[model samples]
Target: MTYSSDYLRSLVREDRVHRKMYVDPEIFELEKEKIFKKVWMYVGHESLVPDPGDYYCTTLVGQEVVLSRSPDGNINVIFNRCGHRGARVLNRKRGNAKVFTCMYHGWGFKPDGTLAGVPMKADFPGGVLEERASGMVALPRVKSYRGFVFASFNADVEPLEEYLGEARRGIDELTDRSPVGKIEFAFGCHRYHFDGNWKLQLENQADMYHPAACHASTVGPDGRQFQRRAGKEGGDAAFFTANGEAVVAQTGVRGFLKGHSSEASLFDKEQSGGVWDEYRAMMVDAYGEERTRDILKNRRHSMTLFPSVDILIAQTSVRVIRAVAVDRTEIEIWPVRLVGAPDVISTDLVKYVNITHSASSFIQSDDLEAFERCQEGLKTEGAEWFLVAKGLGDEVDEGKGVLFGPRSSEVGQRAQHVAWRDLMGA
Candidate 1:
């Protein structure tokens, strides 16, 4: 069934969207071509490939690609396939390799994705292939901002910063929070998948209404007391509550252009009179008292990068989203390191990632179960539309592409679908 632009636009409304958008195979295919490939999607952080010849294999919109460093100190995004039999040239997840040798055939390529050598080259038909043209294909555009790398297959796409728009502030705030104003992606990551669309995770991260309900078991009464006891064991009463779950505000949710949204709350209560005092003092020394106060006194929640990545400043975690099919999606969460900050700050950040967002996390487990259940419910043909009308009539339009409303409001979700509709040509 081919959906016309009118039909696609009809599926999305200001207050709701049809469930078929999440469950239709044809729609998913359209999304891959129109939404994912045409946008600037995150590839990796430069820290992941610190040295020349270091490469990390990853995927964008289900297409396998590699992020590698060239000997001339440049990062290159290369398609993982060998030019010769179309086999993958780099099999391992990551390594420092000067050349990639295809196991299917002895074809080799440089770390910068140039053709290096091909065994039995003399036996090839005369003039059948050219070595220079046989190198791995690179994406049309690649750019890095504040250490993060991104690529786009569309040569005519907007510049990276312009594509980011107001969402760039989230990244800036993230890195600026570090004492040295620099950060690094962590060495380890947590990867997992769910039986649902990729957009569910993006919406769930910024959906403030669910924490008390979906994460009731983790941040609820019993869990709070348990956490208190755990904190006591560690000789810190504010360990878990310092910029933790209960500190995030319900009214801080703000929607941005290009399907981006974020939650921001002043860290007023969380950064007072405890071990956090020492951390605050350290930040004060690095970046004057006022800036340190602003940094430690604020908590910025996750910011969604339209169709792919989510930046969670409070947790120092970057989540990469991959849509595998109509009903399946995978995610990889990488905790980040704030360079030159107090050791405890980094330790607490990693701790938050483990307990809240990792595969084994108490919070993520509940969310995953909810996602799978939502998928099951949508599969029954019992409903046509999913309501995002929670706070529809009362959105406050702050100037400059930012909308504010109750956390339960669908403003962010609506902004997301609006971008989806435009990109999908609906």
Candidate 2:
């Protein structure tokens, strides 16, 4: 298989993606440039930086940036490099400070990327530093759609809202479902590192077909993909904890054109119709029966931010893929808190998801082994390409977009690859 960008693009035929897209280092670099760095990448939530001077540092795509509160109490994101020595100013993943000072040369910068202080004022040429030339490297642009913060390295990209397309509907569905029109993640984040490509996780999230095969608890020997075993970890039964459930019942999983897919099966009313007695009554009373039903009974979906931003369309939490190499990937998980939900509800949100899916989950341990083994096998001469031909000709392309089968098909992967081809000029 000659690995050309055009060839890679041609391999995505509605429901299938060629294996080389995941294995090619050159293609991975191209994606980092054309998709991840070029587009608006999610940073953190507004709650993370509530007060002026409060800040959280994180990577956008692969570029180091900070989500911080400006002097006027506005949340903004800026690159974390010092303008003088280029040393990392905000080294911690998150912190609170009036300004970030470079330890190397005593260069100081405000959250808005403005130069604040300079050591030994009378040192260089005119003995005065120019504000525009000496300030920290601010992002080309920083914007947020609701609470989700995003930044772009390139200056020519479209507005974040425009880039979101119909995906904005996913955010609306997620927020409107919450009683107060906003939601947050609990238990922090559940981080994961995959030996396989990070795209595998994106495809697996809404790829209903893989759950029965790739996930243990939900995967059945036949095609049921439900956990019936009480003994040893069954199929891909990666639970949030030992002897726990792994199924995340979002409202409904749906696929968007260009590799964006989501699931909202966890909407309680739709799953159980707000029928949990007092707790259900409380939710209904707070949000109203009809509103609660809309919140809980509807299928809320998670979305792929085109390339690597997997914004689980239904929750305040998100996973950003920080790809290190073609065969190695680091994922950062960030959960937000709902503005008005009960503590217990948010606690449960983190309990199972963090326990089962994060790096710490024993359930995830088995998944790691499998993905690592798959990586090892793919490197060998055994198979030239991995098969993504599931539900090939049977895709239900609605002219606008195709809906995948049971959240288990490779349609999402194909969608992403096709989008990738278009973006990279493959």
Best by lDDT: 1
**Angstrom error at residue 300, model 1:** 2.4
Tell me the deviation in Å of residue 44 in model 2: 1.5
Which pairs of residues collide in candidate 1? 267-297
Clashes of each: 1, 44
My TM-score estimates for the predictions, one after another, are 0.90, 0.82
Position 238, candidate 1: lDDT = 23
Backbone clashes, candidate 2: 44
Residues 34-57, candidate 1, lDDT per residue (tens digit)? 888899999999989999899999
* Alpha carbon lDDT at 324, candidate 2: 72
Candidate 2's TM-score reads 0.82
RMSD in order of candidates: 3.8, 5.8
Worst 10 residues of 2 by lDDT: 227-236
State the lDDT of candidate 2 residue by residue for 210-229, as single tens digits: 33235555433443333211
